[model samples]
Target: MAFSAEDAKTASAVWEKIYADVEDNGAIVLSRMFKENPHTVSYFKNFTQLQSIPETASAEEIAALAEVRGHGKKVFSALNDLVSHLTNVDSLKATIVPLAKKHATELKVDVKDFGIIFENLLHLIGQKQGGDAKEAFEKVTNLIYEEIKAAY
Candidate 1:
Protein backbone atom coordinates (compact mmCIF):
# COMPACT_ATOMS: atom_id res chain seq x y z
CA MET A 1 0.00 0.00 0.00
CA ALA A 2 1.95 2.91 -1.35
CA PHE A 3 0.73 6.46 -1.29
CA SER A 4 0.60 7.72 -4.85
CA ALA A 5 0.90 11.35 -5.88
CA GLU A 6 -2.82 11.60 -6.48
CA ASP A 7 -3.58 10.14 -3.07
CA ALA A 8 -1.38 12.72 -1.41
CA LYS A 9 -3.06 15.59 -3.20
CA THR A 10 -6.52 14.28 -2.45
CA ALA A 11 -5.68 13.56 1.19
CA SER A 12 -4.06 16.95 1.71
CA ALA A 13 -7.30 18.62 0.69
CA VAL A 14 -9.67 16.27 2.51
CA TRP A 15 -7.64 16.51 5.72
CA GLU A 16 -8.74 20.07 6.30
CA LYS A 17 -12.35 19.08 6.68
CA ILE A 18 -11.37 16.13 8.83
CA TYR A 19 -9.26 18.31 11.12
CA ALA A 20 -12.09 20.79 11.48
CA ASP A 21 -14.62 18.14 12.37
CA VAL A 22 -12.46 16.13 14.78
CA GLU A 23 -13.20 18.04 17.96
CA ASP A 24 -16.91 17.30 17.81
CA ASN A 25 -16.83 14.28 15.51
CA GLY A 26 -13.98 12.32 17.10
CA ALA A 27 -16.12 11.13 20.00
CA ILE A 28 -18.86 10.15 17.60
CA VAL A 29 -16.41 8.08 15.59
CA LEU A 30 -15.13 6.36 18.76
CA SER A 31 -18.64 5.98 20.12
CA ARG A 32 -19.67 4.24 16.93
CA MET A 33 -16.76 1.87 17.35
CA PHE A 34 -17.71 1.19 20.94
CA LYS A 35 -21.33 0.62 19.99
CA GLU A 36 -20.40 -1.78 17.20
CA ASN A 37 -17.69 -3.69 19.07
CA PRO A 38 -18.19 -3.32 22.78
CA HIS A 39 -15.41 -5.74 23.63
CA THR A 40 -12.84 -3.61 21.86
CA VAL A 41 -12.89 -1.17 24.75
CA SER A 42 -11.14 -3.79 26.81
CA TYR A 43 -7.89 -2.40 25.44
CA PHE A 44 -8.53 0.76 27.40
CA LYS A 45 -8.01 0.87 31.16
CA ASN A 46 -11.43 2.31 31.89
CA PHE A 47 -13.30 -0.29 29.89
CA THR A 48 -15.50 -1.41 32.73
CA GLN A 49 -16.32 2.14 33.72
CA LEU A 50 -17.31 3.09 30.19
CA GLN A 51 -19.46 -0.02 29.85
CA SER A 52 -21.19 0.31 33.21
CA ILE A 53 -22.65 3.73 32.51
CA PRO A 54 -26.07 4.16 30.95
CA GLU A 55 -25.97 5.19 27.30
CA THR A 56 -27.98 8.36 27.86
CA ALA A 57 -25.80 9.54 30.72
CA SER A 58 -24.26 12.98 30.29
CA ALA A 59 -20.50 13.54 30.06
CA GLU A 60 -20.52 15.08 33.53
CA GLU A 61 -22.44 12.11 34.88
CA ILE A 62 -20.03 9.58 33.42
CA ALA A 63 -16.37 10.40 33.88
CA ALA A 64 -15.40 7.74 31.39
CA LEU A 65 -17.22 9.63 28.64
CA ALA A 66 -15.09 12.68 29.27
CA GLU A 67 -11.94 10.57 29.36
CA VAL A 68 -12.87 8.93 26.06
CA ARG A 69 -13.53 12.33 24.59
CA GLY A 70 -10.00 13.29 25.54
CA HIS A 71 -8.70 10.13 23.96
CA GLY A 72 -10.62 11.02 20.79
CA LYS A 73 -8.73 14.30 20.55
CA LYS A 74 -5.39 12.53 20.81
CA VAL A 75 -6.44 9.96 18.20
CA PHE A 76 -7.57 12.67 15.81
CA SER A 77 -4.37 14.60 16.30
CA ALA A 78 -2.27 11.53 15.63
CA LEU A 79 -4.32 10.77 12.53
CA ASN A 80 -3.81 14.31 11.28
CA ASP A 81 -0.08 14.05 11.85
CA LEU A 82 0.12 10.77 9.99
CA VAL A 83 -1.88 12.09 7.04
CA SER A 84 0.32 15.16 6.91
CA HIS A 85 3.28 12.94 6.17
CA LEU A 86 1.69 10.69 3.55
CA THR A 87 3.98 11.93 0.80
CA ASN A 88 7.12 10.80 2.58
CA VAL A 89 7.69 7.27 3.81
CA ASP A 90 10.38 8.32 6.26
CA SER A 91 8.10 10.92 7.77
CA LEU A 92 5.19 8.49 7.90
CA LYS A 93 7.36 5.88 9.56
CA ALA A 94 8.60 8.43 12.02
CA THR A 95 5.01 8.96 13.11
CA ILE A 96 3.84 5.36 12.97
CA VAL A 97 6.81 3.52 14.44
CA PRO A 98 6.42 4.76 17.99
CA LEU A 99 2.64 4.62 17.84
CA ALA A 100 2.78 1.06 16.54
CA LYS A 101 5.11 0.04 19.37
CA LYS A 102 2.98 1.73 21.99
CA HIS A 103 -0.25 0.31 20.63
CA ALA A 104 1.05 -3.19 20.21
CA THR A 105 3.12 -3.51 23.37
CA GLU A 106 1.43 -1.23 25.90
CA LEU A 107 -2.10 -0.75 24.59
CA LYS A 108 -2.31 -4.32 23.28
CA VAL A 109 -4.39 -3.23 20.32
CA ASP A 110 -4.34 -6.01 17.79
CA VAL A 111 -3.43 -5.28 14.21
CA LYS A 112 -6.80 -6.65 13.06
CA ASP A 113 -8.63 -4.03 15.08
CA PHE A 114 -7.51 -1.46 12.56
CA GLY A 115 -9.98 -2.98 10.11
CA ILE A 116 -12.81 -2.08 12.44
CA ILE A 117 -11.35 1.41 12.77
CA PHE A 118 -11.24 1.70 9.00
CA GLU A 119 -14.85 0.66 8.57
CA ASN A 120 -16.19 3.04 11.17
CA LEU A 121 -13.99 5.81 9.84
CA LEU A 122 -15.30 5.16 6.35
CA HIS A 123 -18.85 5.47 7.61
CA LEU A 124 -18.01 8.71 9.36
CA ILE A 125 -16.30 10.15 6.28
CA GLY A 126 -19.16 9.13 4.00
CA GLN A 127 -21.71 10.79 6.28
CA LYS A 128 -19.71 13.99 6.48
CA GLN A 129 -17.80 14.12 3.21
CA GLY A 130 -18.71 12.01 0.22
CA GLY A 131 -17.48 11.60 -3.38
CA ASP A 132 -13.76 12.19 -3.82
CA ALA A 133 -13.39 13.07 -0.17
CA LYS A 134 -14.43 9.57 0.85
CA GLU A 135 -12.03 8.06 -1.64
CA ALA A 136 -9.20 10.21 -0.34
CA PHE A 137 -10.06 9.38 3.23
CA GLU A 138 -9.96 5.68 2.41
CA LYS A 139 -6.52 5.96 0.94
CA VAL A 140 -5.25 7.82 3.96
CA THR A 141 -6.87 5.37 6.34
CA ASN A 142 -5.44 2.35 4.54
CA LEU A 143 -1.98 3.84 4.48
CA ILE A 144 -2.05 4.57 8.19
CA TYR A 145 -3.41 1.14 9.06
CA GLU A 146 -1.08 -0.76 6.79
CA GLU A 147 2.01 1.08 7.96
CA ILE A 148 1.06 0.69 11.60
CA LYS A 149 0.24 -2.97 11.17
CA ALA A 150 3.62 -3.54 9.54
CA ALA A 151 5.37 -2.02 12.49
CA TYR A 152 3.22 -3.77 15.06
Candidate 2:
Protein backbone atom coordinates (compact mmCIF):
# COMPACT_ATOMS: atom_id res chain seq x y z
CA MET A 1 0.00 0.00 0.00
CA ALA A 2 1.06 3.55 -0.63
CA PHE A 3 2.13 5.60 2.34
CA SER A 4 -0.04 8.66 2.67
CA ALA A 5 1.39 12.10 3.38
CA GLU A 6 -0.26 12.22 6.80
CA ASP A 7 1.07 8.80 7.67
CA ALA A 8 4.52 9.86 6.58
CA LYS A 9 4.29 12.95 8.78
CA THR A 10 3.16 10.95 11.78
CA ALA A 11 5.82 8.28 11.27
CA SER A 12 8.53 10.87 10.71
CA ALA A 13 7.64 12.69 13.92
CA VAL A 14 7.73 9.49 15.95
CA TRP A 15 10.90 8.36 14.21
CA GLU A 16 12.64 11.64 15.00
CA LYS A 17 12.17 10.97 18.70
CA ILE A 18 13.47 7.44 18.38
CA TYR A 19 16.39 8.51 16.21
CA ALA A 20 17.37 11.07 18.82
CA ASP A 21 18.61 8.10 20.82
CA VAL A 22 18.92 5.68 17.98
CA GLU A 23 21.74 3.59 19.33
CA ASP A 24 20.15 2.87 22.68
CA ASN A 25 16.68 2.37 21.23
CA GLY A 26 17.97 0.11 18.51
CA ALA A 27 19.99 -1.91 21.01
CA ILE A 28 16.95 -2.22 23.23
CA VAL A 29 14.88 -3.47 20.32
CA LEU A 30 17.58 -5.90 19.17
CA SER A 31 18.31 -7.11 22.70
CA ARG A 32 14.63 -7.88 23.13
CA MET A 33 14.64 -9.74 19.82
CA PHE A 34 17.54 -11.91 20.92
CA LYS A 35 16.02 -12.56 24.33
CA GLU A 36 12.58 -13.39 23.00
CA ASN A 37 13.72 -15.28 19.91
CA PRO A 38 16.87 -17.13 20.76
CA HIS A 39 16.85 -18.86 17.39
CA THR A 40 17.47 -15.53 15.73
CA VAL A 41 20.93 -15.43 17.26
CA SER A 42 22.12 -18.05 14.79
CA TYR A 43 22.27 -15.40 12.10
CA PHE A 44 24.64 -13.26 14.13
CA LYS A 45 28.04 -14.88 14.54
CA ASN A 46 29.31 -12.36 17.05
CA PHE A 47 26.33 -13.10 19.25
CA THR A 48 26.76 -16.88 19.19
CA GLN A 49 29.34 -16.97 21.98
CA LEU A 50 27.19 -14.63 24.00
CA GLN A 51 24.62 -17.34 24.53
CA SER A 52 27.17 -19.46 26.34
CA ILE A 53 28.35 -16.66 28.59
CA PRO A 54 27.03 -16.61 32.12
CA GLU A 55 24.99 -13.68 33.33
CA THR A 56 27.86 -11.72 34.81
CA ALA A 57 29.83 -8.59 34.06
CA SER A 58 32.56 -10.42 32.24
CA ALA A 59 34.65 -9.07 29.38
CA GLU A 60 32.79 -11.22 26.88
CA GLU A 61 29.43 -9.99 28.06
CA ILE A 62 30.55 -6.39 27.93
CA ALA A 63 32.01 -6.87 24.48
CA ALA A 64 28.85 -8.53 23.26
CA LEU A 65 26.76 -5.64 24.53
CA ALA A 66 29.08 -3.21 22.84
CA GLU A 67 28.85 -5.11 19.59
CA VAL A 68 25.09 -5.13 19.88
CA ARG A 69 25.05 -1.41 20.53
CA GLY A 70 27.27 -0.73 17.54
CA HIS A 71 25.19 -2.93 15.27
CA GLY A 72 22.07 -1.29 16.64
CA LYS A 73 23.42 2.07 15.54
CA LYS A 74 23.88 0.81 11.99
CA VAL A 75 20.41 -0.70 11.97
CA PHE A 76 18.86 2.56 13.12
CA SER A 77 20.87 4.51 10.60
CA ALA A 78 19.46 2.38 7.81
CA LEU A 79 16.00 2.83 9.27
CA ASN A 80 16.45 6.57 9.34
CA ASP A 81 17.37 6.43 5.69
CA LEU A 82 14.21 4.52 4.89
CA VAL A 83 11.96 6.66 7.02
CA SER A 84 13.31 9.81 5.46
CA HIS A 85 12.33 8.52 2.04
CA LEU A 86 8.83 7.39 2.97
CA THR A 87 7.26 10.11 0.88
CA ASN A 88 9.07 8.82 -2.18
CA VAL A 89 8.29 5.18 -2.75
CA ASP A 90 10.81 4.89 -5.57
CA SER A 91 13.61 6.12 -3.38
CA LEU A 92 12.46 3.95 -0.50
CA LYS A 93 12.37 0.84 -2.66
CA ALA A 94 15.72 1.62 -4.18
CA THR A 95 17.22 1.92 -0.72
CA ILE A 96 15.54 -1.17 0.69
CA VAL A 97 15.95 -3.55 -2.22
CA PRO A 98 19.74 -3.71 -2.11
CA LEU A 99 19.74 -4.14 1.66
CA ALA A 100 17.09 -6.81 1.31
CA LYS A 101 19.13 -8.64 -1.30
CA LYS A 102 22.22 -8.45 0.88
CA HIS A 103 20.35 -9.90 3.81
CA ALA A 104 18.95 -12.69 1.68
CA THR A 105 22.16 -13.55 -0.15
CA GLU A 106 25.13 -12.38 1.89
CA LEU A 107 23.71 -12.55 5.42
CA LYS A 108 21.34 -15.41 4.58
CA VAL A 109 18.74 -13.93 6.90
CA ASP A 110 15.36 -15.57 6.88
CA VAL A 111 12.70 -13.21 5.61
CA LYS A 112 10.49 -14.10 8.53
CA ASP A 113 13.06 -12.71 10.94
CA PHE A 114 12.41 -9.28 9.50
CA GLY A 115 8.84 -9.54 10.67
CA ILE A 116 10.00 -10.54 14.13
CA ILE A 117 12.28 -7.50 14.36
CA PHE A 118 9.45 -5.29 13.22
CA GLU A 119 7.27 -6.74 15.98
CA ASN A 120 9.88 -5.91 18.59
CA LEU A 121 10.34 -2.42 17.21
CA LEU A 122 6.60 -1.81 17.20
CA HIS A 123 6.33 -3.00 20.74
CA LEU A 124 9.08 -0.62 21.83
CA ILE A 125 7.39 2.29 20.10
CA GLY A 126 4.09 1.43 21.69
CA GLN A 127 5.61 1.10 25.14
CA LYS A 128 7.56 4.32 24.94
CA GLN A 129 5.53 6.54 22.65
CA GLY A 130 2.03 5.07 22.94
CA GLY A 131 -0.61 3.90 20.48
CA ASP A 132 -0.45 6.57 17.82
CA ALA A 133 3.24 6.09 17.14
CA LYS A 134 2.79 2.35 17.14
CA GLU A 135 -0.11 2.58 14.75
CA ALA A 136 1.77 4.83 12.37
CA PHE A 137 4.79 2.57 12.40
CA GLU A 138 2.67 -0.50 11.83
CA LYS A 139 1.81 0.79 8.39
CA VAL A 140 5.38 1.76 7.61
CA THR A 141 6.65 -1.60 8.83
CA ASN A 142 4.19 -3.44 6.66
CA LEU A 143 5.35 -1.56 3.62
CA ILE A 144 8.96 -2.28 4.44
CA TYR A 145 8.20 -5.96 4.99
CA GLU A 146 6.48 -6.19 1.64
CA GLU A 147 9.47 -4.70 -0.13
CA ILE A 148 11.85 -7.03 1.62
CA LYS A 149 9.68 -10.01 0.88
CA ALA A 150 9.58 -9.08 -2.78
CA ALA A 151 13.36 -8.86 -2.85
CA TYR A 152 13.65 -12.25 -1.22
Each model's TM-score, in the order given?
0.85, 0.89
For residues 1-152, write the lDDT of model 1, one tens digit per residue: 66788878888788777679776666766776666676676777565567675365554344337766777778888888888888888889888999999989988888888778777777877887886688778878887888888899
Clashing pairs in 2: none
Q: Judged by TM-score, which candidate is best?
A: 2
* Predicted structure 1: lDDT: 0.75
lDDT of 2 at 76: 86
Model 2 gets an lDDT of 0.83
User: Which runs in model 2 stand beyond 4 Å of their true positions?
Assistant: 48-51, 54-64
Local accuracy of candidate 2 as per-residue lDDT tens digits, 1-152:
66789899999999898889987888877777777777776777756445554243343343348767888789889999999889898999999999999999999999999999899889989998999899988988999999989988
The worst-scoring run of ten residues by lDDT in candidate 1 lies at: 54-63
RMSD of 2: 3.1
Q: Candidate 1 regions off by >4 Å?
A: 47-49, 54-64
